[model samples]
Target: MAALDMLEREPDLAFSLNGLARALKVTPMALYTYFGSRDDLLQALTERLLSGFVTVVDGDMPAIRRVEAWCFAARRFFLGYPQLLGLLTWEGGNTSVAWFDRSVVLIEALQELGFKDAELSRAIIWIWTSVMGAISEEIRNRTAPHSLSPAQVESLDPRLHKPVRDMLMLAEQPDHFDSFFAYHVERLLDALRAIAKRP
Candidate 1:
């Protein structure tokens, strides 16, 4: 859709039927023929954005590893389309059919490890939230200007917030985003592994 292409090219542009119609060289009423309302259009855009999300993983791998692979792939997908940040993080974000399609991959893997009902649901929520959080943070770090400089950190009172000062200093260095992402992914996998082994 031309509207989707416009969004991908300029993500920050506020989405409106009027704006989209103008971009497409059509009247707002023309869009109403396709989308019932703004909410309908938003859902369609989200579905289109996430339709390609579930890439094939090595099915022969352990179920836990397969799920882990899904998490990493999800990270890459978000990074590729940072515009999804606003859509997926807000209200009604997970209501679209594509969201369930992507989530079923993890659900099946967790089911293979004996998870069911609430436990399975909780695991899915945990993994999805973690991936979304990491991707959001990574995008902010890359696009937003650093708030504190090394010199600013040096000027802080020595008696206060040592860890904050230290963190600021470290923040000045190149971010090891992949390594940081892998660490959290491992931690989440560890928790899932424990859950799978429960009596």
Candidate 2:
């Protein structure tokens, strides 16, 4: 749709039916014929983006690794298209059909290892929340206006909180860590494995 194309080119622009119609070279009222309202259009857009989300993980990989794989996939999808940030129905990745399908894959993987009910629910929340938290922070830090300078960003020490400094040191040197996203997701997966081992 014209609105989607507009967003692709300029993600920061606020979406409006009039703006969409203008992009398509049609009258604003004409948009009503295709979509009932802004919400309807947004829902459609969300689905369109989510359709590309990976739905399956490698069965040969360990369950914990499968969690990492799926979470990373979700992260890549949204962060790749940061413009959808505002149109998203949920704060993180929860508002779309892709979220549901990916959750099932992770949940079933946990179930295969004998987790279910409350234990299962908590695991699902923990895994996806970690994924969403990481991606959301990445979008803001990377795309948000008024970013700190290279000196400001790279010069870390007493100015930043301990954990914050440690976490971000690699951003200044992307090569410092093999991959930041993989690092955190693996950390979360380690914790998840520990949690799963609990009685």
User: TM-scores of the models, in the given order?
Assistant: 0.81, 0.71
Deviation from native of the Cα of residue 160 in model 1, angstroms: 7.0
Q: After superposing candidate 2, which stretches have Cα over 4 Å from the reference?
A: 1-4, 12-21, 26-41, 90-94, 144-168, 176-178
Cα lDDT tens digits for candidate 1, 44-89: 8778778768757775888888888889889988787776666654
Error of 1 at 69 (Å): 1.5
Q: Which window of 10 residues has the lowest lDDT sum in candidate 1? A: 88-97
The per-residue C-alpha lDDT of model 2 at residue 127 equals 70
Model 2 score (lDDT):
0.67
**Candidate 1: clashing residue pairs, number:** 0
lDDT of 2 by residue, 1-199 (tens): 5555787787766656577778989887776677886556556657775666775677687777677677777777766666555545544444655446546767777887667898888877777677777787777666552335557655767567455655556576755323767788778867777777788
Measured on C-alpha atoms, candidate 1 has an lDDT of 0.77
